[model samples]
Target chain A: MSLRPLLIPALLLASLIALFGALLLGSTPMEASRVLAALAGMADATDVTVVWQVRLPRALAAFAVGLALGGSGAALQGLLRNPLAEPGVLGVSASASLGATFALYYGFFSVSAWLVPVAAVAGALLATMLIAAAAMRTSSVVTLILIGVGLSSFAGAAMSLLMNLAPNPFSLSDMINWMLGSVANRGFPDIVFAAPFIAAGLTILYAGRRGLTALTLGDEAAAGIGLDLRRQRLLVVAGAGLATGGAVALAGAIGFVGIVAPHIVRPLVDHDPARSLIPSALLAGLILVLADIGVRLLPTEFELKLGVVAALIGAPAFVWIAMQRRTISAEQG
Target chain B: MTDSEQKFELTVEKLCIRAGGSLLVENASLDLRSGELAVLLGPNGAGKTSLLRGILGLAPTATGSVRLQGRAFGEFNPQQRARRLSYLPQRRPLAWPSPVRDVVSLGRYAWGCAPGRLGAEDLGAVNAALAACDLLAMAERSTDTLSGGELARVHCARAFATEAPLLFADEPVASLDPRHRFRIMQLIRDHVSTGAGALVVLHDVSLAARFADRLIWMKEGRITADGPPTQTLTESRMAEIYQVQADINGNHVEITNPLP
Candidate 1:
């Protein structure tokens, strides 16, 4: 049998292995037997505290954030019918980061931790709405992409303005660290705050995946085949918004995972956008967990940030994929 | 007694289509009955495509009413409309390099079946369409690997797989070779012979004269003539519409030269 049928299952197995490896390797390494016993709640108190309190939430947080980005990326690429379409490139992640930064700058997190996530979701939703509206008004794909670029630039400018008027160095540093993105010291409460939005978003994306499949035939033909363009746009925008917002809230602005994971999984799924969703999500989650593990294993004096590590790996893959696409198109021409 | 073939499958009345602040089709009216193959003929800017789009509700209609099978067009939802009328647009856009079988299976979308998970009936329909289009050999190949003519046939197979009662094809034979063009026209003719209706746009006058049961001629957003091919296509009409001298024989049109 071909490798297509075995891909998702293999990714699942890899994810389990990665999660276990993440629990085992940290600043203070522990034995596998002790970690398994601690997971079963029969180990010493120190092992239990370290396993249950410290590593478990951080690992799960990284996986969940990856799931959000990868799934959203696949959906957006299908909707736009563009290989390069992703939350980071389309401005949704940057907008969500701006919202979280706003909350951080204004001391809203001091009042309640939930405010940051809520603000990020709001930012993502607003950006998605603007893009969807522009999509309806024009039939040009380049125009829609340019609008996204404009939105990203505007959000970046607004973020810089907030940083320029910081009240204190402590809050400014907090903003900077959040922007860089890491899962260290993350607890269950952080996961609890972002889980529902992510789940809802992914569920909606799964439900509307058939629309993405129909969209392979282009917009007018898809519409002619009884696929409702308006409804499809709504599902993609709202789903991507909620999921990316939650990821930004949980980890903060992780980029390129969305683009790279889907690109890798597309060929495996035979390039059907509907079938690519779950595999892309699984592969991306595995990638982030592995990246987090790499972060801990490095010999740097200071622990590396997860977002920085992800970009360091993902940016190169992105360039390679772009080059591969150019070569294919040129060959076709 | 009037048979089932006499019943009207589609009717458009006083339709006006507008785009970019200009009227594309103005006060156009036509009716297609079961088992009838109609061809639309026009100059480049004569609004043949616009009329088809206006009737299908794909374009912005300023004023018009369409009825399919005796029911108002607005009464049916998108799925219901798709089951009744299938459209093959001029521009064929395939985003990804999906396999040919997968793309053809998308015709079953209105029936709630995706490409990988097709029911028995859907699979039968897809296989039949592939065979009809002579694409069974390329079923496993990616669409991006196909030539221009092959891609056009793929889109045609996708439309045929739907098996809708009414088919509207916009320049389906534009990119095809002579043999394939005749093959596609014969396919449409055969499809209508099964008590279905088809309205196709064609640029080849000889092909339309041979296959189309009726001809509808449009000029500057208005239809100027509508009838059987022999009566509608004449020397004077050709000169008036195309500004060319032409000789019209039985199922053959020979244009001598453009009028200076």
Candidate 2:
């Protein structure tokens, strides 16, 4: 009994429900009808402004970021043949964050708002190429993770250096806040900036799904099955880089949605890594929207960072998933 | 002995493959023709696997050219090469828990159609492969849950699904039970009977004597003997190359002593 036909629709429905819930929850309780009216262009000024200018774009951006991460994570797991492979684990997000922060420190955003994201994407591509090179040299998961950790630590240090060299306290705090990763005060422009890259990245990943499936039998077998190994590596690395770079550019390095979402949905698709992409993306969008709503309603001294809240939920989920995998393997043995 | 066939041939000439600046296979030349089964036998470090990989173009060769069906092996694109030959490596490499049917269908990857969107012919081929390997009942099961013998059968089924003219298997019966060893050997013979050729590596001389149409003995990166099983597994060659004293008795090789 294949459940794939039901899985995508079920996830899309859940995502829509979460998106609607997110749009209805802010400082003031906007009625669902009013939100719908504003969406349909028949609402009053305040309602229209609240729904259109404030809530909708942020929710969509959060969803888009999650979609990118989750899709990339699933694709990367297939590419690397490791269930734990993700953008964060490969240092892609961290390197992109460093690039964005570097652009901010040097006032590139003042010259052109597009510069930060462009820089971020470039940095992500560079990191992805380096990691891909290292991965090609060895198939050991621990060695790949170690290389990624080294790259991540280096990127984190570079970001810290940029903060230290800031000329003013305003600049320092600004960099710090961006590093915290939030979707607040964002408009449709962020979505516009990210959508194309994410779309392109997803297309590349989608094209490589068959090759990825062939790779489940390892490199030689994959080649014997007519998959060009170098081409598959390029597709996956470029796709993951574009998606993760665009995501970090918009949302400032939100964590764990990539790692967590795929784990949540892998079983539904019979553990086929290639088939897990869309469902994982849908579930991740729902998770991010729900987390964004939770942050808005938390009633803290200050609104929580989207990344902070996500890590708070996701880091533990990652630990639990890892432990669960260990138990499963133990039982199998 | 289909070695005289002119329609399909894989020719490896003056092949030299190296890894980490050391030669693994040197000046090895062999020909595989349709409807022939050639079993490669060698002791450990004798470069049997390297020669197989070299012939399949999976390893980098220092100086050599492999021709498949009269086309230079390197000149053929991945799809063309895959359509000409299928290789089952020594490793059991079912990493994911993909369904048995899906995994088997992956053999047709060179057909250039999506697995889920397989044409009727492709689907028929996949079904035939599953049925041929006696895995029809386990088609829906996940490959991760399969036993060692079942996994071997599934892999063999995948190779069979290619329907290519030439097959290369490295130590395909390394760790199987006696029943499965017999089954895998019979499966290879059956594949060769279908007018395709197979080059399989094995350590068991008795099994090789039973199933192989020809035997090629390798020692230290060179071909020591290449002929029919009767002529290649002589007492002196076995003693000299494999350091074993063997007695050949009517399609069975009995190793009598390990020469020190």
Say which candidate scores most in lDDT.
1
lDDT of candidate 1 over A181-268, digit per residue (tens): 7888899999999898899899999999999999999888898888988899999999999999999899987888999999999988
Per-model DockQ against the true two-chain complex: 0.82, 0.72
Which DockQ-derived CAPRI band holds candidate 2? medium
List TM-scores for all candidates, in order: 0.95, 0.95
The DockQ score of candidate 1 comes to: 0.82
lDDT of 1: 0.87
The lowest-lDDT stretch of 10 consecutive residues in candidate 2 chain A is: A168-177
Off by over 4 Å in 2: A167-178, A327-333, B1-6
List the candidate 1 regions with Cα displacement exceeding 4 Å.
A134-147, A167-173, A331-333, B1-8
lDDT of 2 by residue, A240-262 (tens): 88888888888887777888988
Error of 1 at A256 (Å): 0.8
**RMSD, model 1, all Cα superposed?**
2.6
Over B90-185, each residue of candidate 2 has an lDDT whose tens digit, in order, gives: 875766778898888888889875556678888888898899889999999988788888999999999888888889998899889999999998
